[model samples]
Target: MSSFQNDTAHFAGLTEKQTATARLLAEGFTAKEIAARLTISESAATKRIEALRQKFGGITKNELARLAREEFSGSPSSHTVKVFEKNRDFSRAPDGEKLTWKNFDLPNTDGFRNSMPRNRPETELNFSDGFTLDATPPWRARREERLVPEVLDGEHAAPARWAYVVGAAIGMAILLLVLLAVADALGNLA
Candidate 1:
């Protein structure tokens, strides 16, 4: 058999579609390319790749491809190849033998009919415990609670205050120099 067919022979447990997906993946096809080539949706192709990952003991795509090539190339002592061969015999149990919820009681349909109040009279509205019917707005009620007030007031203000001080000092220095120059000119005029 050709190498591709021989490589795929190790994945006998997979469905035909899954087998095709594994082959395409081993051939270095992207999920989008696999989808287009197999006439399946991209999501379906992605799911097939994910299933292949799981079936091969959660190895990556590159590792899976390498394992496939090694197996096909007749490397008989590969542990991963043995795992693939062992997974083939794991047939699912019959439906009747499987655990299901058939014996559980069906839920009561009428139990939720009046669970919530519907159109109660406004006069009958009383606040429950831990609840308030008061008309006070949230912002007014919690006006004392400031978010990050320390960071806003202390940390941010320090740099701004230093900048203002430096700017004021520079302004004063420039004003003093201008005054000195004007006094020197007035003395020269005299």
Candidate 2:
């Protein structure tokens, strides 16, 4: 028997639909193509693929395919896949009327008292006294004074400063030499 057939034999409990989906996926068919072939929605095909991934304890489609192939081919895999029960109660919302910020007591920071949205109570949105909305750009404000390190602001910086000066002087000299060479070549041509 082919490896794929052998692998499928090991997973005999798979539903007919799951088996068909897996076969198509193993054959490199995209979810859209599989959906069309199976007469199902693309989202349904994607969900099937995700379900297969979860069943095989695979984080990726490729891993899921490998797991399927290994299981079908009678190869023993080290990882054990766990099945989880779906929780219906987790999807339920709390049983109560919707509560807005107006229902709670909050302090207003800004002097403007009427900034709350229409129909909402004044206590809905409150800013603390420490909060200040400055219209000016943050960068334009006076910055805290910082002390400069001696290496950067004192005689310790002389060596680096001199190095920059010497480097600039050398670059200028090279530029002048190149210009002079060009001028000499033009003069020779004339």
Candidate 3:
């Protein structure tokens, strides 16, 4: 809202190339050299410098140089410090991490047992051939086991039920004979 807010806010709106030019200009680079360093046309670089001057209220080259070191020149708030702080941390990581592969973690195969590319001194891998199998078997099994007993299926349950009833009858007859013998001995003693 105020006329003299921080200028770094506008710097945020500038393209990456503009930011690079500001940085180079601050570092004592000429327009031509800045263009060569960035692989851009000199005129384009010059235009960017002119644009930088306009953004800082028509500042001359010296004033532009001054503004390059300034924290905020374009709008109000200075974000350059924050941006550089972030970039300083980001550059230490691998390029794959900085780019589209930020989620990729470096491989740490410390506990992996089945690591590939086995380095055998004698055997070599055949590319076209399939992988080699590494299985072994004993000559014969030591223990002998009989087949499982045949289960009485639903249809055969009727015949099995009669056998169970016969077994129950035999058990009851033996029990009754014992009880009768005990009663006869008691009767004789009376």
Predicted model with the maximum TM-score = 3
Q: Which prediction has more favorable TM-score, 1 or 2?
A: 1
**Can you write out model 1's per-residue Cα lDDT over 25-91, one digit (the tens) per residue?**
7667889999999999999998888887776667556656655555435555333223233222223
Residue lDDT tens for model 2, 64-83:
55455555455454134322
The TM-score between candidate 3 and the true structure equals 0.35
The order of the candidates by TM-score, greatest first, is: 3, 1, 2
Give each model's whole-structure lDDT: 0.65, 0.63, 0.65
Model 3 global lDDT (CA atoms, 0 to 1): 0.65
Residue range 1-190, candidate 3, lDDT tens digits: 1133445666667788888998888777888999999999999999999998777666456545655655434422233222112233444755422322134577778746576646755456445646765554577544556442334335676777777779899999999999999999999998
Candidate RMSDs in Å, in order, are 18.0, 22.0, 19.1
Clash number for each model: 0, 4, 9
Please estimate how well model 2 matches the true structure, expressed as its whole-model Cα lDDT: 0.63
Off by over 4 Å in 3: 1-3, 72-190
